[model samples]
Target: MASTGDTVQNLPVEEAVARGGVTEIEKGARDSTDELRHYQSSDFASLRDEIHKEITSRDVLLRKLEESVTRLSEDIAPVKDYVMAEMEEEDDDASSSSSDTPEDGAPQDGDQETEEERNIRALNRCVDVMMSLTEIRENNEEKTKKVRGFYEKIYKASPLTSLMLKFLERNGGVKVIIDCDSKDISNLVRGLANLDGEKCAGTTLHKFADFFECKVYLGGEAGKYQVWEGLKWVDKYHDPEASLSQSLAQMVMYLIFKNRGFPYKCDDDQCEKLYEKIAQEALQKMTSGAYMDYLINDALSMKTPLGREVSLISVVPGMLVKHGSQGGMRTLQEQVPFLTYFFMQHVIPKMRSIIN
Candidate 1:
């Protein structure tokens, strides 16, 4: 070994370098790279834990969404079912009516009804109207009209002629008189009542004389007194002297009397009774089917001059019927069908326009 090593050393550096000088250095570099490529068990465990966490989070979110959807479906299901049942009943009724013509050409009774049964049916119809009232309040104008029509149909079909009489009496403490017999009041002089003329001292007086069975001027001390008396009667509607139509007339007068200007031409002094006169005028305007616009045009414009800006819907909070207030009962529009009908038709349509 000494001889061979000594001979190689002496042989010259260039001839020895040609054989395999850097093989060990190359082997050491390859071994270090192989060591670094090995993955540890702890790293694999950490990656698995992260994946599990993400899977659990996704599962929780999915479950929460499903629960929310389930709750919403549950809430709507009953309403859907009730509406379907009502539609089916109506269809059945329509089919039976068309198919069942009696032998004498008269409509046959689907079933014989007793007195108690008729009463019960009428009660059901009233309940249906009550339900539809809430429905109309919740729905939009287009849908509300359909719901209201259902209630109207029910009311028209009912045999109860004096429905408003008892309802007004119980809720509004007012009486409903079909034909009020007030004496002739047109021939009476304005001076006799000390009523304000068109050129009154404080506010110009508008002649409501023809509007009533008698002559009465609005926008004066007497008109205020009448309003007070009317409110008193209405607030205590159960009293022996409560008149629904009179109370409503007072409320309407109170709302618009301040905008005094002119009056509509009445046929005659006693042509139409007070309540009938007011209702007929309202009915005539209702033909256009927009109560608020009718009031703005027919009531406000007819009552006041063009420059006056009087709004019936928008008023001071004090104007709303509250406890000890002189205007009306707190819920005047709800109890009196006249007010209720007009208010809903106006307010609902206004709300829809605003939303759009």
Candidate 2:
């Protein structure tokens, strides 16, 4: 009985030890499972935080891109406007260029008529006078006496007629006067005559005598004979070297007017026409070298034909003293002022009738 009790106790002890070992193994497994579960939960939380941060950063970048697009659209608007404006300006320039015409393409409205037109008009007006003169000359061709008598009568009636006759006697007769005064009657007579005799009637000797008379007239009324004596004295003594040009000019004027009689009277139309014809003839005669030289040298050179030297210069600033010192120089200078005064006092007032 003691041996059975001992075996029974040993069996109870073995059963207790097996139970304690099983309990320890189960506790260790439970602890490992809990540790694994905790680690997994922490890893999951960290991953979630990283993903949220990435998503928020993406949202911020999208907002900035939208703002940049809006700014770019605003900047492009002005550029588009500038381009449109430049295109419009180019179109306007093109249109203006197309409408323009070159200067050489056409005549201007304000251009003047040509010289040929004026010449044609003047020629037409001259035809009638020319025809009448031709008829008179043809009719009187064979009757030298009758023609001479007719001319004499015409000469006595009009100063211009007498002048024309005188000019016709020269080689290149009665052409120069026409050239100088085709439009003026009085100038024709004035240009051809000497002071004392009619230019048309005087011979070369008479012309010289007439020049002496003119010198006397200008010299303040020395007797005619005395004047002749004085010219003879000049010929003998003072400037025997004097040119004949001045003497010739004076003779031309005198001869031109002497035969016609002073203050040539004419009220009739025939007389007027005769005067015009005579004037034209005189002009035609005087244009030659002999007549032109005589007029220019003799008439133009006569300063104080009476033999008194007249000084014409004025004392003014900037004038050279040397110019005033010479007698002829001074006289020439005075002519300008005298002419200016005369034109202002006489010519300008008479110009009303002549102005267009």
Candidate 3:
């Protein structure tokens, strides 16, 4: 019986020990699971916040870009329209203007012109005038004035000034100048100096005059030579790369001696004095704003000649100058034609021998 009591007590103790071990293991597992879940939740929240912030920033950037593009397109719209209109062919205008068949008896697309084509035509007109320089000089006074008035339009409205240098170069050399402005005998003298890049094949006389004759003409005591000396640079007047515009400006300077006419082959001491006087006058006029003022005031009005309804702003935009507000560089460019006519009509007679 004593042995049976001992067995019962030992059995109870063993059962209790097993129960406690199982409970402790289950509690440890539960704590571990809860800690893992808490850590995972915190990490996921941080990742989600970062993703949301990135998406919001991208959205704001996209909106700002859209607004900037809208403003830019609006700003360029007028310029775009103007360019398209200018580039459009004249077929539409011609078809609308005359319902009657063209003189050729049928509509010809090739006959229509764009703004560029019209400019080319005007450039051709300049070529025609240049070819007829001698005949024009012999023309009667009234006819000459009419011709002058007509050509004045070509210089003012057309891109002839910008295109003149290149065009003259391609379609033969100094001949273009001779044909275009016969009255401007001044150009005859000055034009010879610029034939270095011209197509003057086998023209020994022109090359000789270009190198030797015009050198003396431009190298007078107070002329281009002295101007070069003042600038402290070697004179490149005869350099092949010399600019046509500089040659033109030099012609303007020589115009002061128009009363006496340019001495192409002459060597009188009086000619030397005249060169100095003209140089001083040019410097003073350019520095004192007189040259600019004259150009502004005397520049031709393009409003009436281009068309009945054309405005000055349409022809030349961004006119900041006060007097010639209608046309800026466009107006200044007209000086080429105006000076050409003046030199031809007024100074040619005095230097007829030089031209001949």
lDDT of each: 0.32, 0.29, 0.33
Instruction: Tell how far residue 22 is off in model 2, in angstroms.
Output: 99
Residue 184, model 3: lDDT of 24
User: Per-residue alpha-carbon lDDT of model 2 for 169-217, expressed as tens digits?
Assistant: 3312112111111112232233334333234321112112233233211
Residues 102-216 of candidate 1: C-alpha lDDT, one tens digit per residue? 5455644653333234444544554454443231212455644543343333333211111321132123322111111111112222332212223322122222322233222
Q: Judging by TM-score against the true structure, name the best candidate.
A: 3
Candidate 1, run of 10 with poorest lDDT: 234-243
- For model 3 the TM-score comes to 0.22
The TM-scores, one per candidate, come to: 0.20, 0.20, 0.22
lDDT of 1: 0.32
**Candidate 2 vs 3: which has more lDDT:** 3
Give the C-alpha miss distance for residue 279 in model 3, angstroms: 7.4
